[model samples]
Target: MHPFARSLVTFAAATAAAIALHAGEAAARTPAKPTIAFVHGAFADASGFGEVTSRLQDRGYTVVSPANPLRGPASDAAYVASALQPVKGPIVLVAHSYGGAVATPAAKLVGNVKALVYLNALALDAGESNFGIIERFPNRFGEALRTRPFPLPDGTEGTDFFVDPARFREFFAADVPARAVARMASAQRAVSLSAVQEPAGEPTWKTIPSWYLIGRQDEVISPAAQRFMAKRAGSRTVEINSSHASYISQPDRVTELILRAAR
Candidate 1:
């Protein structure tokens, strides 16, 4: 073979190999299925996110909606962060209501969390407590709650809060199905008062890119407060004309925001 022809063949092979290597690198950077970790707020469990979880699953995403414990903010955060220890890929940590307080610090503990989504959720800053912010931006839902004392694991007493069942639709999910709201009211988990008064952990939104979905008609967390927190965090925000349970009444809109964060 001619020396010139041999040189040309060698160069072509090298170029093809380099192109293959670059393609492999790009594929590695793109995750086929990113994990999404959902944290539910007070008076709710992982089941609170049932519809949203199903939607995400339909879109080829692995969703984990862990029971939030509804304990205190720090302990709840630690519980959620520990759940993520076994997950192997990038995570989009999504929170609802008080769950936002949990996700805020939990994200800091996980290195692979790529995005944060708050759905009518609390985005408390450092040194801030949920009740403190609620006091500052009072909502009608406060009037609807009925508190009762319950024995803790340590045998001490703790306060548990619940919205009046008759007023559940108005306070939490007026736009949701009546039957569903009825079931929710019957099965509602009580949120410990301590959880609301506890100071939140470090604000993860400071470092993580976040998206917020505000329930404009929310009586639980006033719309004004949601806007203030979202703006303060510099998050991409969208508003839905629904109750505090926007994810239930306006699932599409909520899912759209989550998809935006995942992308």
Candidate 2:
């Protein structure tokens, strides 16, 4: 081989080797993406998070959509905290509606929750009850809710709150497509009366960062109430023309807000 050609080959090999080493080092230094744990609110199940969860997963994020036991605030929070125990790294707890009441305390319990993302969710303060907050805001939501009696563990009857099937689409997901709204209305899960009535514990938002996506057209939890909580929690807030079921109706915007929190 000619002398100049040999030198040029050696220089190119060295440059390529250096670039590879830098790339390897950068990859090693990058932290793993946080696990996104979604907590669905009352009168709903984990399936509510399907679109957002799938979007996060597609971007290489580990996601957990745990079924929120619609019991009471304390117990539901405990259940969510326990469900997240197996997640190895940092967590971003995303809650909707009543699930926010659960995630507010559950985030603190998880110890590794780096952010709380509330999607038209209830971000209650210590000693503040969901109904207490709702009544203060005054919406047509009360007229849509109905209660059914069931036996509790203590052999006493307890109430499970549900949206009247006829009024479900109007109150919860008016912006969502008709077919999807029908599925949601038929598959609605009942949240206990205890869940809304129970007072929230110390909110995790004060300590951890928070992002809130407020639905301006929300009837279940009035936009007024949502704005009040977002201001009180000092959350990074975004608003959309949506109903309470923002995840189902406005998945792109909802997913974007969550991605911001995760980042």
Residue-by-residue lDDT tens digits, candidate 2, 56-88:
889999889888889998999899999999999
Best-performing candidate as measured by TM-score: 2
lDDT of residue 197 for candidate 1: 92
Which runs in model 1 stand beyond 4 Å of their true positions? 1-26
How well does each candidate superpose onto the true structure, as a TM-score? 0.89, 0.91
Lowest lDDT 10-residue stretch of candidate 2:
48-57
lDDT of 1 by residue, 77-159 (tens): 88899989899989999999999999999998878899999999999998899999989998678778999999988999999
For candidate 2, the clash count comes to: 0
Clashes of each: 0, 0
**How far off is model 1, as Cα RMSD?**
3.6
